[model samples]
Target: MLSWVVTFLIIALIAGVLGFGGIAGASVEIAKAIFFIAVILFLVSAVVGLVRGRSNI
Candidate 1:
């Protein structure tokens, strides 16, 4: 999932360089959304792990 953010970022950069304003803007927005979702999922997983008494967490 995090890799998707990197992929979108690369696409945005390339699109911007190639003068594709709309594609670049949309890719950037998608990347930002994916990043936030990944962070939220990580936090939720950590909390769940802790609640389950997992020392590795």
Candidate 2:
């Protein structure tokens, strides 16, 4: 979910600011992975919509 991606990203930023190196790193990695998955899902949804004869797509 895009919201999850933003949440993890904010967590990473706050942890980094608070000097938590390991937590910051892990959070950033998780955020990156979630963002990628969200993007992939969006693209797949777009393609599927187009194929299904959706005019809005």
Candidate 3:
């Protein structure tokens, strides 16, 4: 999921450099959304791990 954010960010950068405003804007929005989702998932997983007392983590 984080990888997807990175991929979209790279696409946004490339599109912006090529002057494709619409694609760049859409990619940036997608990247932001994916990044937030990844962060939320990570936080939820961490909370779950701590609550369950997973030593491996």
Candidate 4:
């Protein structure tokens, strides 16, 4: 997921350099959304793991 975000960011940079304004804007937005989603999922998973580990003790 994080890799995908990075890929999109790179694509946006390339598109912008190539003078593709619309494509660059869209790709940047997609990258931001994916990055946030990945962060949220990571935090959720970490919290779940901590809760489960505590229960086992």
Each model's lDDT = 0.97, 0.92, 0.94, 0.95
Candidate 2 lDDT trough over 10 residues, lowest sum: 48-57
Candidate 4 has an lDDT of: 0.95
Residue 18: error of model 3 in Å?
Answer: 0.8
Give lDDT: candidate 2, residue 23. 94
Estimated TM-score per prediction?
A: 0.91, 0.87, 0.88, 0.90
TM-score for candidate 4: 0.90
**Which digits, one per residue and each the tens of the lDDT, describe model 3 over residues 1-57?**
888999999999999999999999999999999999889999999999889894755
| Cα error, candidate 3, residue 35 (Å) | 0.5
lDDT tens digits, residues 1-57, model 4? 989998999999999999999999999999999999999999999999988786534
Better of 1 and 3 by TM-score: 1
Q: After superposition, how far is residue 23 of candidate 4 from its true place, in Å?
A: 0.3
Candidate 1 or 3, higher lDDT?
Answer: 1
lDDT of 2 by residue, 1-57 (tens): 989989998999999999998999999999999999989999999999889874654
| Candidate 2, RMSD to the unseen true structure | 2.9
Question: Evaluated with TM-score, which candidate comes out highest?
Answer: 1
